[model samples]
Target: MSSSKTIVLRSSDGETFVVDEVVAVESQTIKHMIEDGCADTSIPLPNVTSKILSKVIEYCKKHVETPNSDERSLKRILNPLILTL
Candidate 1:
């Protein structure tokens, strides 16, 4: 695969994070934003707190890095509420 692009995400509390496109797209919400061209700048996650968003980003990065991991295991890492958009 070629080098993955990066995406910037802004949390509700104004915290910003730069993550790989592949990792960002792990969230259906972010995937749609990219598909709709709304990610040209930073994607704002107004409903998610910085703390929760950080956890979500970490989870996504791990998921993208480990393609062989089981779905059940992924679901166990964080609260289900945080996983949903």
Candidate 2:
């Protein structure tokens, strides 16, 4: 697929999320739906608000940009500091 492919997600608070298809798939539910051919259009997330979804998208983007770097994982981040102490 082209790198430019994106999927639109609609939040419960009437917010629209137009994000990379990869980023959107971070949500397991969405991923399954996509795999099952249920994501034909804007995926409606009636349970998650825009603010929360925005954060989720941010997290997704970060992980996508650095799949190997565990900077975002709490366990990875805390382990280093804990070891020092």
By TM-score, who's the top model here?
1
Tens-place lDDT digits, model 2, residues 1-85: 2358788888999999888888888789888877888778888889998877877777677667767775458456445444544
Clashes of 1: 0
Candidate 1 on 1-85: residue-level lDDT in tens?
A: 2336899999999999988888899999999999999997899999998888888888887777777877687667555646564
Clashing pairs in 2: none
In candidate 2 the C-alpha lDDT for residue 1 amounts to 26
Return the lDDT, model 2, position 43: 84
What are the clash counts of all predictions, listed in order?
0, 0
TM-score of candidate 1 relative to the true fold:
0.80
Distance (Å) between predicted and true CA of 11, model 1? 0.6
Each model's lDDT: 0.84, 0.77
The numbered model that scores best in lDDT is: 1
